[model samples]
Target: MKVVSCLHAAVMVSDLDRSIEFYTGTLGLAQVDRDLNYPGAWYQIGDFQIHLIENANYQASDGIDLTVSTRNPHIALGIQDLEQAQQRLLAANCVVKMSNSGRAALFTQDPDGNAIELTLVDPERESTKKFDII
Candidate 1:
């Protein structure tokens, strides 16, 4: 399967409201309507989503070294097929973590320990127009 586009990038934060204000007020990202099913907020970045998750267990500025480098911040990419991507990653001996949200997602790491998330694209949400980067 091929990566269709970048879906979202998740960043952990201590305060969700503060981060939301910074992203929306400071950065001028439009806040989209989302279900508060979890401790996070979704912002519209052109056609992509920026997910700000409030993780009380972990702080973004924490200097503690982690075993898995990919456990830090990560970027999620949209893919054509989730199962095919999982199989490809497994075949390459890449460590893949399944999403607990039951969404079609696979989290893995690069050689440098950078986290990467592969997610299945929802056809209904796909945009046809190209995003103009300023």
Candidate 2:
């Protein structure tokens, strides 16, 4: 019916190996095993995950300090109903983009082009922390 919790945050990284080391070493987040046929790594932090998608061409957002602005890099929120969420976003004239991966999720922007994802996921049963292979 409403946003239940933050599922994860998708961040674009330049180097997979380097970023992975930083996240698992410096940040001390357990790396979760993920094979999405894409260049990315997932890490576990309590009930939430940090998804890092490797992009050699990745560049930080303009002057706006995205860390506080919450733009470009996005957070995915767990929702009860996909259709209901989509309807609400659409009603507010928000642009919605369905997940191309066929998952029960949709993407939208927060007026500032910062991507927000609404996904149907149960965080309680979804933590990959226990399944950490690396």
- The runs of at least 3 residues in candidate 2 whose Cα sits more than 4 Å from the true structure, single-residue gaps closed, are 62-134
Candidate 2 to native Cα RMSD, angstroms: 14.0
Tell me the number of clashing residue pairs for each predicted model: 0, 0
Q: Give candidate 1 misplaced runs (Cα > 4 Å).
A: 61-134
* lDDT per residue as tens, model 1, 70-111: 355766566667788777767666677876556677676543
Model 1, residue 39: distance off in Å is 1.5
What is the C-alpha local distance difference test score of each model?
A: 0.63, 0.65
| TM-score of every candidate relative to the true structure | 0.46, 0.48
Error in Å for residue 11 of model 1: 1.2
Name the top TM-score candidate.
Answer: 2
Instruction: Give the per-residue lDDT digits (tens) of candidate 2, residues 77-108.
Output: 65656788777767667677777666787777
Clashes of 2: 0
